[model samples]
Target: METATIHDERTEEGRRLTLHGRLTVRVIEDISPRLREMEDDPVPLTLDLGGMKRVDTTGAWVLYRLVEHRTEQGFITELTGLTPRIEALMAQVGKANQMTTIRHPIRKRHFHLLARIGAWVEGGIYQFGTFLAFLGLTMLALVRALMHPRRLRWLAILRQAEVVGVSALGIVGLMSFLVGIVIAQQGAVQLRQFGAEVFVINLVGRITFRELGVLMTAIMVAGRSGSAFAAQIGSMKLAEEVDAMRTIGMPPIEVLVIPRLIATTIAMPLLAFYGAIMAIVGGTLISWLQLGIPPAIFILRLQEVVPLTDVLVGLIKAPVFGIIIAVTGCFHGMQVEGSAEAVGEKTTAAVVQSIFLVIVLDAFFAIFFTALGWA
Candidate 1:
């Protein structure tokens, strides 16, 4: 219970503030009010700390502030009788305060903009790195399964295939059909004004076979199966089932991810081809009912107008889109931590990221094919 004693004395020379006893945080409450009322004269001041038996950062701060206030009034200050230990402590405290006093003159708006841009760039890099790592791990698992066929889980693959493909056929087909009908109606109306309504057959056939069919199918699967994959895996993560598999020397990637990834990849092309056929059927029906073109004539014209290249292009894009969707879903799922709220967030992110990547890949494919004279 060593109490601090601070005494200020003025003489013809200048002023002197004598500090003794334990000048630490505990003594601060007792010393504050009296010190605040002390004079801050614009003259040389002396701080005598030789009597001080103990000093902490708080006490040093108080001494530094008193010296600073007097110095700011066009005065000089000095500390006398400091041992090596106390001097070193005061030096460190002074350095800390000096850092706080330093400031760079920059516009606040520009500073904020730079901070935000930097944060965004950092986040982008982190996400890209994690995605590459996830992709590599998945590829390794697939390669291992390929090398050892017995390690592959056939039942799981079949089950996932059923979930990702067969169960989704009805909704995907119906949606593609409705979209095709809309396209045919719109194309026919526009072409009718030019006495070329029959060309609507070419429009529907080419667009559905080359672009809309597979693109729409990918989006549908992302919204349906990608979200499901994330929720399922995330739930497993929350239950520590993934950890258990790892503990038992079973690679969770092979057990959980391989089946889903392979199933989605295989299912995508089939779904895309099926969706294209359904879209063609819908367009043909619309042409027959609304435009008075017979279904047989529409199918005949579709065959004549749509080339094998367009179908090939759509099917080729399907597997890549499936890979993106599956990888994104599984990656987000494995990232899940904390509670069920995290599962919901990851599930939503899986759907959104899958759709975004599908569209971007579609754009690149379109450009690449066009440059290759396939457009």
Candidate 2:
């Protein structure tokens, strides 16, 4: 390898620096300080690359930096070169350096906060619109299925009912039963202070039938069946099966969404009722064992104090909760993009959105029933 050399000469026009030999990585560090000195000179600079030499990207970067430094200082800099390849190499290096030197404007903190809030509001509105559109489409599909009973997928509905309802019974039953025991135990503790421990039956019966049974059942279904719906449909979407159905002139809503919706709607009320019964049984057992309130007396008090309206309140909300969970899950499933990661993401989102919406809907129902003097 030839040694890299930099020879400076004083000329009438300016100070001329001639680069010679192989200007590669080996010599760039040694030559950089001299280049920086030349940049600081008040006189105009001319870089002469006509000398016999070899050059690579590292050497080209050094030369590019020298020119850029002089240009930035308002000094006239000239490059006299011969080879097309070196010129092209230097041009690319120059462009890359220019790109690196460019700085983006810093955003004001208050303005950025406002922009973020605006974006959040925009996203919320967009999601609301998407949900409303999905609801409308589902209603239309239901109407079409109603007009043509043969179009209804009975087998799929049964399969989904088993998946969403029958399969979930044990977990729902256990959760509600445990919740009832806790409520009864806590109510007994509190009521004993007022010497009214027997009223724990009223508290347990009213709360389990009117609120907790249906709410807990809906939340469990959202986490279990809602996520399952999203995962199943999302995987089909990723496989292009949903698109293939569309190409074959089958509406995905009719074939997929309606069955799940119908199955969930039928299943929720039954599950809620079952959950309520198990919860009452659990409370009765706790009352008997812990409070020394006999099973017979507890049952008699429950029947007399807990009205039919209390049970009806929760049952009425069950189908509505079912619809919300089903629609949210199916909507998010269809929105999944073409990837396994997207399917997973949409499945998680479906569960979260369904559960959140169920809670919100439950609150609204509570307020509405209270307004009607039913609570």
TM-score to native of every candidate shown:
0.73, 0.75
Runs off by more than 4 Å, candidate 2: 1-101
Best by TM-score: 2
**Clash totals for all models, in order?**
0, 0
Candidate 1 lDDT, 1-375, residue by residue in tens: 879887889978788888889878987888866655443656667778899998888877776677667667777788898878787876787788754566787778989999999999998799889989999999998998999999999999999999999999999999999999999999988999999989999999999999999999999999999999999999999999999999999999999999999999999999999999999989999999999999889888888999999999999999999999999999999999999999999999999999999999999999999999999
| Candidate 1 pairs with clashing backbones | none
**Model 2: which residue pairs collide?**
none
* Model 2 local distance difference test score: 0.91
The positional error of residue 239 in candidate 1, measured at the CA in angstroms, is 1.5
lDDT of 2 by residue, 13-111 (tens): 988888888878887778778887887677988888888378889888877887878788898999887488788888999777643466898999999
TM-score: model 1 vs. ground truth? 0.73
